[model samples]
Target: MKDIARVSLPGLHKSSGGFKSARQVLIIDGRGHLLGRLAAIVAKQVLLGRKVVVVRCEGINISGNFYRNKLKYLAFLRKRMNTNPSRGPYHFRAPSRIFWRTVRGMLPHKTKRGQAALERLKVFDGIPPPYDKRKRMVVPAALKIVRLKPTRKFAFLGRLAHEVGWKYQAVTATLEEKRKEKAKIHYNKKKIIVKLRKQAEKNVESKISKYTDVLKQYGILV
Candidate 1:
């Protein structure tokens, strides 16, 4: 039952010698071209109410000319009025926040319920070993290797996963679409169970309290 509420952790736990729950932290390592893919995976987990932590973000793959890409990004930002119009020599570009924030938009967090789950995400540039340096971990190969473009839909979906702190796991050698859909179903099922359990607990508590109060009034100490 505790597993239902599990959130992802970025690295190994020292004293516990494992995760606080079976659920773990998501970690990705890549550069440039692969960065978007990795981010997509992370964002997926975040949407499922998991806590996520990213590592070695700068090393992720990038497929294009770095300078040219930066220029294009800056131009886009300029057109969007991302900076003060009066300011000169100022430009906006990709940073971890930009990358992660983009993924957040993919989520349905505008809803009150989603906003409640949005508090679990965390992003970092390098391994944040909880116990020791040796304890640092990486995402399973099954979680990585998903390739999504920068299209609007992809960006939206990827950001939703990011906000939830999902990890990339491409190690199973399964088709990308299948693995993602499976993960999504698993996440949704777990969420439903957790919600139902909370409601059940509340109902049980209410019954018990009501009975106990009645007994007390009748001089029964149960």
Candidate 2:
């Protein structure tokens, strides 16, 4: 009994498992990335115990016929419990939630490890405050430009989500307003800085002129 107790299982403890092996936080920029490819990479990273944050989910691309993709989404919406429609295979319309669901499908979400991995994953529609300042990692292999040929048609995740009642336009409008406000603040600050600089220069010039006048009064000028 003592020996068995001392023999610890590999993943039985949090400090000794896959979580300990990979504790790094990975911030992924989802812009221009192929949805499936990005989801696959993120799923693997999450399973390896790395905390993954995917930003700009709206910019992620899906490589396929745009119309076909819309049709697919419409078909998916048709799936629901017959008895009570709400009982329900819920479908997410937001790009971030759509990406989250994609990654979740790749993980064994019913199990404890999978749930733990899911817990470490975060998907954001846009780059939020602190994360906006952080350096984001990009997967070259998962980029749409690299994976899809120029001739192939592709649709943005944001566009698709918007079509499916995601209110993406409203969200983007809000973000635009915030950006404009920030720009206005920055411009005001610059104006203040320039005004202060001119004031200081005038002060220096006035002081120099006063000193020159004092020298003239003393008959010290050439």
Candidate 3:
């Protein structure tokens, strides 16, 4: 070969002092996306050393008859050896956690490198603040609306999460609390803005009043 093309990563580089690695922080919106496809993409991105944050995990879709898929998951959760309960695989009931487990299955999690890659992944049931306003990318290939066939029924992870023992009420309460906090913050800022504007207007009126008083000496009466 005449030459090897030099390939450099965006946030990963080697230095004389230490091994430096920096990767892209990718934020993905999981709403209305297919679980397997989304998980595969997330796994690939994390393995590339990029940080992946998946939001709205509860809204992710799984293709199949709703009840069938539900029962299938329930059966899988029951897998355990009587003698080695501690050694059996653990499953998560929360929608966010279930989504995380799906992603984990796509990775070679038994190895050290796979575990490290998994550390870069984050999944949330809903859009959390700080990420709520950020630009979130959607996986086109995994979108249910775009790819759904009218004939095949579908199921949402949100419903499955509830059936699997996730506390839906608690999630709702927390989300409501967060919304209230954000609303309060916004109201406070608006109040401060209105106060400042009124103060400025008063200052201008006072200056005009002073100017009018000066005009009194010139025989200009209001």
Candidate 4:
């Protein structure tokens, strides 16, 4: 367990399990490659009664089998519904561990202490400007390397550039321009190819049928 402030016990890795610290705030930004690792770390603290506030949750990863994962996510929400069909208004909300890992990990601790510690966690997608408006500190050297992921492919490349620590907005913008340009060309070519193939097949079929009639007239059954 790495040394972090506000906790009397070492983090999850060192000890057997739960820590009984009072309400401590843990903030994690959810926009980079390290989200899952960070979330797991924060969740452990949360389970120990530390107040956790996650920021930028929408950026979390959904690795592999997106459809199946989505169904699994929906199922979790279904479980959290307030009332069954017979009872009261149905409202479904579930915890997110990318797929199901968060709730599963937290709830399944062997001890009763573990169960009690799992209740204080909270996560969110984005922090409102007001949440940390007072402090505008420079990124730490470790986190200076950390960056936000892009919304689209070009944005991704922009992030890649930023990872190398370059700040090139114009190049990223140009990459998007090129992607769109190439997409247009590809669409046009595909449309033309389909049209040509259909016309060629029609011409061949007509010629073959006309030749078949000629053969029939000569008593060639084919």
Candidate 5:
């Protein structure tokens, strides 16, 4: 395995001693990046024994005609064992899975070291929480707009996956609803806290006023 310290790339902080610490994790933002290019970079990092986490995989782009990409995926879906289709090859419909598979292809996945390297890689469709709060790095070399020609057309990995029956929209909608619900709950809790704080302040003011009156009547306060 190559030392991660020697492999310098954009957005990756350099360290002298390589990835000696297990806590050294690289969070990559896959938004607006070419799928193959991004996967290749990530595969290299993983092979170097560095843990890599790729988020926003849905935004990854593939260089080609959108329709032709869908057709290729459709054809891939048709591949199966004649004897037992269930026991043979499987196709992934999710963009994250597609990216993961792409990275796997770049590695020596059949070997134990490759398998271990793959175990260190994590790919996500969207920026889920914890990761959402974390800072994500971008590979300048892997950016679609940076590498692709101005006249060339491309398809988003998510869109291509959806065209092939990924149900991305439905899943995203559900996740959106859950996020909205959580936001609403948090807002309501904050409102309740403010209301309770105001009520407590009002009660304290009333008690203070009563004590002042009693003190004035006793000629203790003027």
Candidate 6:
């Protein structure tokens, strides 16, 4: 008992085995990467306890006819618990969410430990800040554009997301530009209102002074 009590924490490093190793953080770029292969690799790494951050999620690829795949998504979207939208099979429209759902299907997410492992995964739509400067890893087995034959045709996640009502299209300034223009119009209206208010106040003050002078002569007001 005395010998065990005297043993320092460092002395028990090998015996304890709990804190022997730390999990590594990994960044994967999804640009032109196959969705199924990427999901498989990510599932394997998550099982190994590595924290994964997937970027360029909109650039991820699904090898199928674009229109057919989009129709499938529409079918998924049509499924909704009418009584309660909260308890839903919640099909996501965003590319990042779609990629994440693909990864979840690969994992044993029914268990508590599996849920924790899934929590370690982070998915981003584009080169978000902080990750933009970091080095990203590429899996050669999962490349889409390279794997495709000259005659083959497939859909990209970005296009699929747009078809499914994803408003963050970097190419077309449809939603964003409209919002900016509306804001400018609002600001201009506010400026006009302020200018008119000041002019009205000045006219009112001049009228009040003239009335005061007239009243003084009549001794109605002092």
| Candidate lDDT (C-alpha), each | 0.47, 0.82, 0.79, 0.45, 0.83, 0.76
Clashing pairs in 4: 47-117, 56-125, 57-125
Candidate 2: which stretches are off by over 4 Å? 1-16, 19-23, 176-222
Off by over 4 Å in 1: 1-23, 30-33, 80-94, 128-222
Give the residue spans of candidate 6 off by over 4 A: 1-23, 171-222
Compared to the true structure, candidate 3 yields what TM-score? Answer: 0.68
Rank the candidate models, highest lDDT first: 5, 2, 3, 6, 1, 4
Scored against the true structure, residue 196 in model 4 reaches a CA lDDT of 100
lDDT for each residue of candidate 5 in 10-98, tens digit (9 for 90 to 100): 45443563355645688888889899888888898888778899987888999998999988899999999988899868899889999
Q: Model 4 over residues 1-222: C-alpha lDDT tens digits?
A: 442442333342323444433423455544442433454556556565565555444434433334555455455445543555546333223223231245436455577766555556655423443333322212121131343234421122123223333344455346546655766797899899999999997889876987878889999955
Better candidate number, 3 or 4, judged by TM-score: 3
**lDDT computed for candidate 2:** 0.82
Candidate 5 accuracy as lDDT: 0.83
The whole-model C-alpha lDDT of candidate 6 against the native structure comes to: 0.76
What would the per-residue lDDT of candidate 2 be over residues 1-222, giving only the tens digit for each residue? 232223223343333344453325677889999999889888987787767899889999998888999999999999999999888899999999999999999999999999999999999987787776566777877888888899999998898999999986577758857855876797899899999999997879766997888899999984
| Stretches of model 5 off by over 4 angstroms after superposition | 1-18, 173-222
TM-score, candidate 2, is 0.71
State model 1's lDDT.
0.47
Show the colliding residue pairs in model 3. 11-22
